[model samples]
Every structure is written in C-alpha cells, then in structure tokens.
Target: MEDPAQRRVDYGDRSFDEADLAACPLEQFQRWYSAAVDSGEPEPNAMTLATAGPDGPSARTVLLKGVDARGFVLYTNQRSRKARAIAHEPRVALLLVWHGTHRQVAVRGRAEVLPRAETEAYFASRPYGSRIGAWASEQSEPIASAAGLHEREAQLRRRFPDTGSPGDVPAPPHWGGYLVRAVEVEFWQGRTSRLHDRLVLLSRDGSPAALDDGAAWRLERRQP
Candidate 1:
C-alpha cells in the first residue's frame, strides 16, 4: 500500500482577508457559494452537519436546501439520529468544503425546526421519486436488506402513482427541515506551505444575530 503520509497537496496562492469579506457573514457566504457554483463544483451546497447529544457528537453530510438572512437550511427525517441529537442539544455545527475552489465555510449555530409550511413547500418541490423514497425509508433505521427497503418503496409508489405531478405525494409527517441560526461563520482559503487564510465572523453578543445586521457581527483573522 502507498504511504498515506506521502500524499501532499500544495493548495495554491488564494488569500482571504477581512477586506475581502462581505458586509456580514451570510453575505460573504453567498459570495463564496456563488464562486463555488461558477467554478463547476459538484454539489457545492452539500455540507457536513454535526450535532451532539447525551450519547456524544455525530456528523453526516446533508444537502443544503436554502439560505437567507436567517441562516442555512437542510431537510431530514425528524426521527433521525441528527434530529434526536438536536432535540437533546440544539447547538450544532456545519462545514461546507469546496475542494475544487480550495475553500471552506464553517458555521456554529442553533438548529430550529422549520415551520410546517416551509417544509411542505420544499417537499412539494422534490422529485417524484424522492418524495416516494422519503416516505418509504425510515431514515437512520436498520433494515434487513436493500430489497426490503425497495419493497417498501414499491408500496409507496403504488399508493402515490407518480404521474409527474408535484401534488401527488404529500410530505411525510416525520420529514422536515431545520434552519441553522449561526452565531459564528468562518471562511477559509487554501494557500501554500499548509498556511491557510482563515477569517471568522462572530456575533458580537455571542448570540444568533440577524445575518444582515452588520453591527451585530465582528470579523477576525485567525493564525493558520
């Protein structure tokens, strides 16, 4: 086997300074997000979500569904491990890595359950197959076999009969979304010699302040 330690990547000369940041963290995030998309980064909105509970911390990758002045949003099963963890401890962290762009964004925040209306609207926007799968599989649950899961999906497909209509399948009661109200957002840019650029935006009062409130946040650079 090749030596893993021998693998090296000299991340180019990109630099991120305070002046490069937007008025607020969310704005800065949008700029970076757009750059990642324009760079042809596949699944640029995918992010690692971390939550802690009595058992400990757990993390998984989830696709970002939306973002606004409130923060980032993602959907999942309400009964999943991550959701249970959020119930125990609302505080969570998110990391979005854009390998193609040699950049990353980290967020520390509180996860709040999205309103049913929002969840329903987003769910309705999902592909017909995805809608069926959402109801068929119990996320994070053990199953005897993939066949069994497919069988369950088959049953839902029979019930919903996908006619390419968004209203055909309604959102499952347990399937919903969460909005991460960020207290701190950090942007990182890769540079040579393992010395990266890290600029962090923090809520002045250490709370989840409005993302657009320029006075509510302060930016700081960290040693990299």
Candidate 2:
C-alpha cells in the first residue's frame, strides 16, 4: 500500500486579510464563491453539514441550494438522519471547502426548516427523475438491494409520469429544506508552511443575525 504521508503539496502563499474582506461574511462568501466558480471548481456549492443529537456528532456532505442574507440553504428528506438530528438539536455547523482555490469557510449556526412554499418551489426546480426518486426512496432507511430501489423508482415514475411540466410531480411531504443561520462564520485561506490566514465574523450578541447586519457583528483574526 502507498504511504499516504509521503504525499504533500505546498499551498502557495496567499493572504486574506480584513482589508480584503467585505463588511459582511455573506458578501465575502459570495465574492469567494464567484471566484471559485470562475476558476472552474467542480461542485463549488458542496458543503459538509455537521449535526449533533442524542447519539453523537454526525457529518455529511450536502449541496448548497441557496444563500443570501438569511443564510445558507440545503434540501433533504426530513426523515433523514441529518434532519432528525436537527430536529433533536437545531445547532449545527457547516464547512465549505474549495480545494481549487485553496480556501474554505466554516460556519456555526442553527438550522431552521424552510417554509413549505420555499421547499416546494425549490423541489419543483429539480430534474424530473430527482423528483420521482425523492418519492421512491425512504432516505436513511436500509434497503434490501439496489434492484429493489430501482424498481421502486420505476413504479413511482409510472404513477407520476412526466408531462413536460414540472408540476407533474410534487415534492414529497418528507422532503424539504433547511436554512443555516450562521452566528459565527470563518474564512480560511491556505498559505505556505501551513501559516494559513483565518478571519472570523461573529455576532455581537452571540446570536444569529442576518449577514447584512454588519453593525451587529464583529470581525477578528485568529491564529492558524
């Protein structure tokens, strides 16, 4: 087996300072996100969501579907482990890694389920097959076989055949979205010798606030 420790690459020296940051983390994130996209980074919106419940801490990668002053948004089956964990404990964390840009963002926040209207709206925008799959698969549940899953999906497709209209299939009741209201947001930029630059924005009151509320936030530089 190859020795994983033998592999190494120096992260080019890049500095991200307060002077380069936007007044708000969301805006800064948007700037970085745009840069990442322009650099041809694949799946730039992919983020790791971490949740804690009675059992323990759990983390999974979920695609960021929306973002704005409200916070980062993602969709999933409400009955899934992550959803259940959120139900047990709304406090959660998120990590967005953009390897191509040698940058990452970390967020500590609370997850709130988006309203049904918003969830349905986003669900309707998904691919036709994805809508059917949402109905066919019971997220987080054990399945007998891959064939069985495919068969269930096939059955759903027949029941709700695509009619060239997105409304042909509706989002399942268990499927919805969550908004992560970030109280603390940290932006990291890799640098040479692991002396990374870390800048964090924290809510003045230690509570979640809109990303545009610059007056209610404080920015701090942290040791890498």
The TM-score of candidate 1 is 0.98
lDDT of 2 by residue, 144-211 (tens): 99999999999999999999898999999999999999999999999988899999999999999999
Q: Which stretches of candidate 1 lie over 4 Å from their true place?
A: none
Clashes of each: 0, 0
lDDT of 2 at 223: 97
How well is each residue in 26-83 modelled by candidate 1, as lDDT tens digits? Answer: 7888899999999999899999999998899999999999998999999999998999
Which residues of candidate 2, in runs, are more than 4 Å off? Answer: none
Model 2 scores a TM of: 0.98
In model 1, what is the error at residue 213, expressed in angstroms? Answer: 1.6
Clashes by residue pair, model 1 = none
Tell me the TM-score of each prediction against the true structure: 0.98, 0.98
- At residue 110, what lDDT does model 2 achieve? 94
Where does the lowest 10-residue lDDT sum fall in candidate 2?
6-15
